[model samples]
Target: MKIERTQTGVRMEKRLLKVLKALAEHQDRTLGDLLEGIVLHAFEGRAAFGDETLQVIRQLKAVYGLELTARDSHRLEEAGDDR
Candidate 1:
């Protein structure tokens, strides 16, 4: 199936973005493509990556210093936000 894509500004944490970009490069995919696949999988309540891919993600996270986890979802505050 062919899907149309749109360009928009999306803000993300610096280290997490670095890890995501590196992972996309490692898998020879565009960052947008990777994010689309991950979101599609999540929509279906499916796991986006297998053990090997997860291992790669772990390494990338370590290299980029992205320590955020699922538990941190919905709890993130902007860098300058004091609330």
Candidate 2:
């Protein structure tokens, strides 16, 4: 099925967006396409990706300097006030 998509702006961490863009290019897909797939899978109570994709994600995570651990799941304040 073809779904129409609308362009929208969203605020996100700069490095995170960089990683997502790289991942999209690595997978030969668009950022919107990848995010839609991930979100839809989550809504269905399923893993968004399999082992292979996870590996690719890990590589991208490392390249993007994202050293997130299982215990890092929590809200983090900005490093410093930009203003």
Top candidate on lDDT is 1
TM for every model, in the order presented, reads 0.95, 0.81
- All models: lDDT? 0.95, 0.83
Clashes per candidate (backbone, < 3 Å): 0, 0
Tens-digit lDDT track for model 1 on 1-83? 88798998999999999999999999999999999999999999999999999999999999988899999989999989988
Q: Which residues of candidate 1, in runs, are more than 4 Å off?
A: none
Clashing pairs in 2: none
Give the alpha carbon lDDT tens digit for every residue of 1-83 in model 2.
Answer: 98899999987666678888998898999999999998999899999888998898888888889875546546544679564
C-alpha lDDT of residue 21 in model 2: 93
Residue 16 in model 1: lDDT: 92
Best by TM-score: 1
Report clash pairs, candidate 1: none
